[model samples]
Target: MALELDGFAVLHRIGANRAAFEGISSEVAKVARSLLVKLLKDKRTGVDGVRAVRAALGAEPFALVVDGLTDAEIKSIAKRLDKHNPVLIDGDAATVRKLVGALADGSTEPASRPRAASRGNAKAPKSKKEPTAPKTIARVSFKSAGATRGR
Candidate 1:
């Protein structure tokens, strides 16, 4: 189905019920947003289409993305993100656009933590102070006139 907007188009196909999938799960939202971004990068759709998608879903793209989408739509979006056993239906063009907007705005998720880059030769942290230890006597003995019973 054509998304209502002029520059939007659904990029994935799924087998789900739009109404049933009202509240978006994080996994679904992430995949939807990611796929939306991928669609933006595609040459077929061009920049205008990408911009339009980003605008529609600005604050809550997942909400708008799944507006008319059913469970079938969910499966469709899922398939586009996945590489195997693709979903059985297509996404609503309008929803895809909104999803892109939402992904760009980033209202739903925080930026992911970047992985620590591995170094071939990493240096250990330098020590600020030398390691010091306390000294202790092996034993203490009291010497008195007859304290030990023998001088």
Candidate 2:
């Protein structure tokens, strides 16, 4: 912001208003939600993941990097930022951690990890559990107050 203010002053001083664009650079900034979701207390590490985020967003991140910062503090900051800037700021620390992880480990939608094929058979795992529910009791009450036996 300070840099922007200084640049604006410089532009106005030199009579560069007419040439100036109404907006700044055009980078589509995703709210930092996904990147922040990468944060994990167990995965605390260097700024490699943060760098990946910067590379992805094409904008310098307004992030709480997990270099020396504690996970609790980062989580608090993230929540607070969400509260303060409901529209703009959004991040899940787990995502930030994952970004770092992908940066270090690399990315691939590898088909080698076989996904389970859905079974058309109703007897399969999805439907099998449905039959385990408690059996409901049905009661047949007499219509007449004094009556008891067969109708």
RMSD per candidate (Å) reads 18.9, 15.6
Count clashing residue pairs per candidate: 18, 20
Query: Across residues 54-99, which tens digit of lDDT does each residue of candidate 2 receive?
Result: 5654443323344334555555433332233222135455653443
TM-score of every candidate relative to the true structure: 0.24, 0.19
> Can you write out model 1's per-residue Cα lDDT over 1-151, one digit (the tens) per residue?
8657532233232214445555655556677666764564454653345345656655465355445355555444433432232112344555444443344454423224456798979898787997679788687565554565545
TM-score of candidate 1 relative to the true fold? 0.24
Question: How well does model 1 score by local distance difference test?
Answer: 0.48
Best by lDDT: 1
lDDT at position 134, candidate 2: 80
